[model samples]
Every structure is written in structure tokens, then in C-alpha cells.
Target: MSSSLAPGHPQVVVCKWSAELVRSMLDITPHVFVVLDEFDTAYMNPDWELLSRAERVYRISDFDSNEEISAVAADLILRRASIDHIVSFTEFSQFGAGYLEVLLGLTKDPMRHVAFRDKRLMKDRVRLAGVPTANWITLADPSREDDVAAVRETLSFPIVVKPVAGSGAIGTVKVETPDDLLPTLRGIEPDPHLKSDQLTAEEFIPGREYHVDALWSGDTPLYLIVSAYYRPRMSVLDTEPGADADATPPDGSYVVNAEDAPALYSRVTDLHRKVNRALGITGGATHLEVFERPDGELVFSEIATRMAGAWIGAVISECLGYEIHEAIARGVVTGKIPEVRPSRPYLGGLHLRPKGPGRITAIPDEEEMLAVDGVLRAQRLRSAGDSVDHAHPSEWCAFVVLGADTREEYEALARRVCDELRIEVEPAG
Candidate 1:
């Protein structure tokens, strides 16, 4: 590996690894240093060619921590003459990359990144900007009765409890009442991804949920995609009393066409613009989740400064004739998101989970899924012999991206696929 970069190749430090993302970054510059966590490196098993192409690759035990990121930056500063950009393609490493951006004097004002990472700070900034958010109270000490009482006074039953800086729905609990508050909060098992014991309990807003993914050029918007969920994401946390776990309905989202949903597109994009301006979002990508009340008021759920996960990018690429990561890479290099539009009327990814806890006797193969009507792409992450764990609904076994010429056809196709597909599981292996 070389310690110095060739002229005209900017020195870029990538906080994580993605074959396509790294490849795109390297296309513009040979001086790319990739920082990856050991677990991701092992699970992804990136190709040797991509790893070899990067100027340097650092595999540390932890990539999300400030200490680890700072240490790596210090080492890079000592080795290289100058660092141009520190970027993160995933949610977990966004803070680390942004933190380093400021520490290296690449940007000013740490709050810009800190506000995005810390739920409390994020809410504070968003609310101060007059964007409606769930009324929340932070627990300095979840074990302390005083903190719990504060939540009871400020919020109602069925509030949500979550880590101050956590992503996804992991480590989140919905507390129904005062009695259940302490027990639920205490029952949250610790995970390595959880950065702090501090939790925030906020009022739960019930409504249809949707996420907006956008690419921005500084303060201006480049492109935005709005997708509505088939069901509340929090529903994945619990299995219905008698529902079959292995036969659980496909839980996923679909892209909303701007013309098909002109009003929805306007509302979400307008809301996103407000939040983006408030958060100081600039030349990059973001995924914002929001809820629409029954009467049509949009409430803020939370926003992340990274790409949407769960094969969203792939589905978007399949429908839009381009990749979101490609747009992001281009934005990083040229401060612009290339113009791209949806080619299909309806597009979405349907995710399937094991209905019941058991041994998997069978699962549809990729070829079988592709044969289904309107199915454009299919990916099977599990095998016939793999054990089925319904407890974690997020761990989907397979998914298919569906494309259609009309919304009616899209709905029919989704139902047909769900009813036809089967995940045969036995009580024991």
C-alpha cells in the first residue's frame, strides 16, 4: 500500500465498505482509504479487486465510535499529507464520518452532524425550527422514578421508548401505560450498536407511514422518491396472537409516482424541504421517515443522513434506470445529483419473513420468484435448510422487486405473490 496519493487523485476516507459505492468513489480518485468494521468486512466478504484498488483499507473492531474514528483519523493525518473528504454510506457510520469532517476542519459546527446522530439534539433542532414532532422527554436515568414520572406528566399512554442515537426499530419499545413503562424500559436488552443508556419516550402518532429519499445539491433538491409502507414498521416488533410467523404477510414499501400521488408528493417533499433547511443538509443523500395523520397532517418520525436500506436502492435502480448510490457518489465528486426519473408506473420491494418458529423445509428460489407476474428481481437470503427465527421479523428470508404499468395491477400482483409463495417450516429439525 502507498502512503502518499498521486496528484489529481483526491484523498478520500470512506467510513464503510460497499462494492458499488467504493467502486464509484475509486473511479474518480485512486486515493481512497476505506474504514470498515470487522463484522461488516467478514459478512460482506468484499472482492479482493475492490479492496486492492483502494489506497488503504482499515479494518477496526468498531467503526461507529468517536474514539475509534478519531484514532483512525489521527493515524491518517500522520501518514497522508491531507485528507479531502470523509464519507459514510451507511447509517451507523454517518456520525463517525461527519465527526471527523469537522475535526479535520473539513467543515465547521459539529452540531450539524451531532444533531443528526443524537435523537434529543435532533428533535430539539427540528422542533425549534417549528417542524411538528412527537412530544418527547429524555430519561437521564431510566431507572429513576422521577424520569418516568416526567414522561407520564408530559405524554399519554402508548408512548415509544428508544435509544437516544439508535437506528432501525431495534431496541425500541412501545409503552402502553405507567405501570408498563419501567418494566419495558428495563427489559430492553443491550446491544453493541446502542451507544448510550439514555432513552427518549415520545407520544406515538398513529397514521399511515411513509419514507422520503432525496438527493440534494447543497440546499437545492436534486431528486426525491416517496415510498409508502404496507404496514407500520413497529408492527414487526411483535407477532399477532395467532398469526403464522412463517406465513407472515410481506412487509415492505412501494414507490409513489409523483403524478399518481401529486398531493402526497407535494406534502412530503415540502415537509422534507423544511426539515432539510432546518438540519443544514447539503450536497448529499438523506432518508426521512414521516407519518400522515388520518385527517392529513404530517408528523415527523425521524430522518437519517444516509441511503435507505432493505433493497430500496436496488428497487429504485430497477425502476428509475439508475442507482441511488451512483447519484450519491456523483454528488460527492461534482456537488450535483444527476437527473433521473422513474420508468415504471409502480415499483416496490416485498419482503417475506418466516411465519412461525421452526425449521425451514422449503423456500422459493430466485428463479421461481422471477417467474411470478410483474416480478422484475428476486433475492433469496436464506436456504431451505436454514433455521427460521420469527422473533426477529426484520431478518427477512427473501424479497422481490415488483414493477407494473398501473397501480391496480401492482396491488393484484403483490397479493398474488404473497398468497402463492410459501415458507414450509417444521416445529423441529
Candidate 2:
């Protein structure tokens, strides 16, 4: 029997990857041996059922012993002479999980992902490399009330608090005073899995938030895309008003939902070069979040070794007219980047949440929602008969996405669309 499989080989391979964006990329890829490693997490979407044609499927469990995970990895490697590529969609799992692949001797090096999941640790590394980051401190002990006081003393007014290691602004809270502290901390436990060993308190930069999507093709960056986050006009104004009102969530909290804001792509080539050099991030696709303070100071928020989450892979792909996730996969497989270029300059996205409480009965004007100029896609994660509560983490049913030729144009259209679009819901019976 031949020890290796070629491009035309009929053999199949499964994958350990999950996440809607990553799964979409894998589904569209051409034939090759794939090993889908984590079945439990990946199975939430019906997309997994389509992988039945893969060469091998490895169902690994998070609850399994490290020994079991290593064993499964070794088994897959032994069955196939080698894996052509290993790709992940998130910063945490890309390094956390990919390290295991390295331990099984599947990859050239594991050090590439040392900055895996912990946002605090990633910032620490980048800071040591002279990257300008937001004024921040991580809670050494989360359960202690005194540490909350300590956070107040160490930081200025309007501190940004969140789990030290989280993604997509999940579990993130912004508090302006001592009175606003406890409820914000407690409200974040939306899931038991949301718990963290520590929390981060950082000086909330009062300015515009932005992201840079860049791919590390070996020792240099290629196709850098810098995006300016639409300042949540609602959150920025609502922060102080709600602070005086109550500590309840979704209603009285100070956090921006990405879906609510539109992101603009700019050719900030110089800033991209400076940030990449500062972080020493030399491999894979990297997503960097930043806050450009009103004084023109560019303060770093956090940087992920992978693409920005919350369907950002799709946003970048749409804006640039290239497949970034697949490009990352192919680069990992071949150690080279094919010639791909940014096709257009545009702004994209609107993450929406419900304005009032009730079970969503119907979304009456979805076609109208899509009719606005530069509105590429509009979707509501919640459907008819779905109920949403005053929630945290910004995952709500009433959402809309818009794309435009200019950031100003997109924001204007989004505000109008949000006002005009309505979710007819029946009040609690």
C-alpha cells in the first residue's frame, strides 16, 4: 500500500475544526485528507453532516485526558504519512489546539502559536516588544471584592472590564464608577464556560476603535487591511445616562455590539507595518483591535493570531474580494501565498439587537432591509417564535448587516434602516 496520498487520491480526511466561518472555508476546499478533530463543538451547525465524505473523522472530546487527545492525533498522523495543512479559525484554539498537533510531531514548530488564547498574555508579549497598548491590569483573583477596589484605584474613570481571555467582545463590560462594578462582573456569567481565572481592567480609551486584518506570509505581512470600527453612537451617549438609571443589562449597560456598528477599510499601510513589527507576529493571519484616542494616540486593545471573530472572515473576504481563511489554510499547507489583491475599498457590517421585549412574531421588511445602497447582507440570528431577554454579550435576534462605498454612507443608511426595520413580537403571555 502506498504510504502517501496525492492530490487526486480518493482517500478522505476529517477535521477537528468548528466555527461557522471556518467550517464554511473547509466545506469549499478541494479534495484532500482531512481530520475533523473536535466533533462535539463543531456539531452545533448542521454543516458537519456534510463531512461524511472526508477520508477520516476523529471525534475528540474536550473532557478527554490530554493523553487521549495526543493519542488521537498520533493515530491520525500514523494513518496518513503527513498532514498537508492544519488550520484553525480562532486565536485561542488555533494555538491551544494546534499545539497538540505539534506535540504529536505533526508540525514544524509549536512556538508560532505561543500567544494563543489569553488576551492579557498576548498584550503582555506585545507590550514587551514596545507595542503601545491600552492602560490595563488583570485581576489576580476574580472572586475577591477588594480586587475590584484595586481596579478602581489603578485605572482612570470609565474602565473597560472583561474576562482576561475572551473573544468577540464577549463578557466585556465598561463601568464608569465604583457603583457600576459588581453587577457588570456578575452579569457576565452567561455560561459556566464564560468563567475565567481572572478579569482585566483597562483604561477605556475614549476614541474610535479599529482593526487590522493582515496575513503573515513567512517573515513579512501581505495584504494588510485596516478597518475603523464605527463608534457606537448609541453606547457612547447611553453610557452615562444608563449609569444613573440602573445596573440591569442590555438595557442599562455600556458595551458596543459589533453587529450594530459598521467597519470601514482603509489603506493604513504604515500603521500596519508598525503594529506587526511591534508584536513580532510573523506567521498566519492576525486580527488586531485598536483604539485611536481623540488626541490621535493609537492605543492597542488586543491582537489575535487569527482573523477577527463574529463573521469577520466573511467581511474581509467580501471587502477584499479574496478568501482569507482559505488563503491561511493554503499558506499553512504550501508555506507560500498566491497572488491575491484587494479588489475594492468599502465599509461593511451592521450587528443588530432587539429594541423591545417579546417573542419575535415576524420581520416584516427583510427585502426593504437589503434594498439600501451598499447593504450586501442582512440577517437576524433569531427567527419567528424565538424569545430574547435583556442579555449580555450582544448576541440578539434583531440584527442587520450593511455594506457601503463610504463609512459615512454606511452609518447613515444603517441608522435609518435600524429605525425603519421592526421586529413584530408578541409580549410575554
Candidate 3:
């Protein structure tokens, strides 16, 4: 960690939706440059007034290649406003930012960024490093019939399929049988953010799933929290036939005590360290998901080189008594990791989705939701006229935050909140 080129401010290049996050970083040091996406201009342009408060803004579309991005970054460096760090807390911006970082001499290796972006490459590296992961094969052209045949011939039933480069569980699916395989494969629409046309067909590991969120200083994990989802993320996509994607499915997640499940904790943390090392991730926040088989074997799910989305950062802050974003900002800017750890015993967060697709007619009152015992925060992400897409968890309409002294207490509070909360929607016509 070197000091910022400027007297006190470190110039950082951030990508996509991370502009808002830079506000907290400004408190630690000034000079945040955001790279925007052109497609987002239609909705984000109006918000630019507030975002422009940063030192500078660049658009990804403006640069045709990584070389161009590096060229512009080099010009900035020559002007004595050298970028101290190039970072993106979102999957969309990681690869490009990493390339720019290497070009600007910010990162020691470039493959670290590549591993973060390409799932197939990542799995290869993890396997080579001797970390346990599901058996997987890549589909270069998913639309091709032969590729679908390859998946059927090789992988077992209930195989997990997802884009080689995707986030937020957007195009992920579980093929339970041969009949469901081709349709599920064909139904995966292209994502603009995913640069690769390849798809992954991996053996589905059945077991309890958990995610570990941690901030690292090189190979050392400075802080860690393990969370278990009430239901696996992919299950949210398994809706009833004719159901709308916006319809909310049943889902909840809560932080778990490491002491209560020491064996599980040890296995997860050990793998987390291995994955970080395999990917060459030396710093920044990481979000990794793993599975615990019924037989008690641990298997890797996936890893991201960014903070967990779905408001997990907020939940972590609420439980730990520190803002993860602030710690990450300070770490990247000054190369100093915080000493803070989780202060609370147990905390949980739940999302309530519309029962079916339609216009949202009504929602539970905020005051009523907050009144629930152990409920810390209640927010309605959708309004009366807003349409709900039930296909994915990302379309869920409302969320509740909860805290309790014990896991039993947290589960009780979450169940009560779900049972009491009401969200009415008219079936889509």
C-alpha cells in the first residue's frame, strides 16, 4: 500500500452501480472516478447530478477495448492524478477494472481479475488448487443441439446450469430430469453484462447451503460472517407452471453462530481461504457460497470478488456494528484493514415476494412490520402500481431485517414476520 498520488486523496476508478458506494469512501479520502454503462444512461442520467459530485466519471462504452481504458488511465497517471486503485464492487465492472489496474501497475497479476469474471476458468483453477467443487462441463454455444446433448450424456440429473460469467443468480437453473434439460438451456436469454457465450452444466450438490462474507488483507481474513438461506437460491426459480417470474417465492436467510457449528465453520473458512488463494485475490471483500452435503462433505458453490449483494452488506453492518463498505474503502485507499469483528450474536434478514405476478394492489404498513418483535428494519421495494416479476429472487418486492440473541429466537421472529406480512397482487391479465 502506497499513498495516494495526490497529497491526501487517492484517486480510484469505480465501475457501474458503485457510484453511490463511493460516497462513503469519500469520507476516508477524496477523488473517486466512476465508469458508467451506456445502457444505464436512460435511467441513471437523471441521477447524475448527485453522482457527479465525484471527482470524475467515465463510460464503459467510450472505450472499445481494455487498451483504450488503460490509455486513458495512463494519461491520468501522467497528469499526476495517478490512480491509487482501480476497483469495482460489482461483477459487471471487475474484468475491465482489473485490466486497467494491471496496465496502471496497480495489480501484481492480471489472471486474478480473469478468474473473478470467468466461472469456467475459476472452477478449473479451484480444481487445480485441490479445492472441492461440483463436476462441471462448459457449453460454448448453448443454443446448439450438440451442446445440450453433451450435458445430457455427461452430467447427472438435476444438474445446475448458469452463465460462465453472471451474477445475482440471474440465469441460473436446475435441470431435474432429461425432459427439462433442453428447455431450461434454451430459455436462458443473453445477458448484456456477461461477455461470454459459454454456459456451465455442473453436478448439483444437494445439502445445506451457506454463504461466507469476509474482508481480507492479502491472504488473511480480517472479518468473516457465515449465513444460511432458508431455501437454496436456485429453488426460487422453480415456480409453478404458468407462474410469473415476478411472483415472490418463499425465501429467508439468517446469520449462523460459528461456535454452534464449529466443524462446518472450519470447513467453509478453509475452502474460502483456498478459493481466495486460487483466484489470486489478495485484498478486498469476498462473497463465497458453499454447500454441506447430507453426508457432511463440503463442496464449493461459487465465489465473487465483491461484497455480497441483496443488501447482505447492510445486514452484515447491522450484526457486526461496522459498515463493510467503509472498511473496504479504507482498505483499498490506505491499504489498511480494520480490526472490527461481529459484535452481535444473531441477526437475520428475510425477503417477501408477491404471491403471483400482477400489479401490486396493497402491501403491509411499514409501522406494522416494524412492530414485529426482533424486527430491526422493514422496507417495501415495490409500490401499488409496480409490476412484480416472480421468475427470480432479484424481483422480490420487500425485505425485513431481524436480530435476536439466539438462532431459535431469530427463526421465530422471521417466521412471525412472514406469517403476518401481507402483500396482495392481482393476477396479470
lDDT by residue (tens digit), candidate 3, 362-426: 88766877888777777877778888867665776777778888777766666667667868889
Candidate number with greatest lDDT: 1
lDDT string, candidate 1, 3-76, tens digits: 66567767778777788888888887888889888877789887778789888888777756678878877877
lDDT (CA) per prediction = 0.78, 0.56, 0.75
Show model 3 residue runs off by greater than 4 Å.
1-10, 17-20, 38-55, 59-68, 192-195, 237-249, 335-343, 365-368
Weakest lDDT window of 10 consecutive positions for candidate 2: 248-257
lDDT of 2 by residue, 283-395 (tens): 66777777777876667677776766554555666655666656666555445655754332444554454555667787645566677655565555678788855444355
Local error of candidate 1 at residue 26 (angstroms): 1.6
lDDT of 1: 0.78
Which pairs of residues clash in candidate 3, taking residues 3 or more apart in a chain or in different chains?
245-389, 245-390, 245-391, 246-388, 246-389, 246-390, 246-391, 247-390
Candidate 3 local lDDT, residue 316 = 80
Cα lDDT of candidate 3 equals 0.75
Order of quality (TM-score): 1, 3, 2
Which ranking of candidates, highest lDDT first? 1, 3, 2
TM-score of 1: 0.91
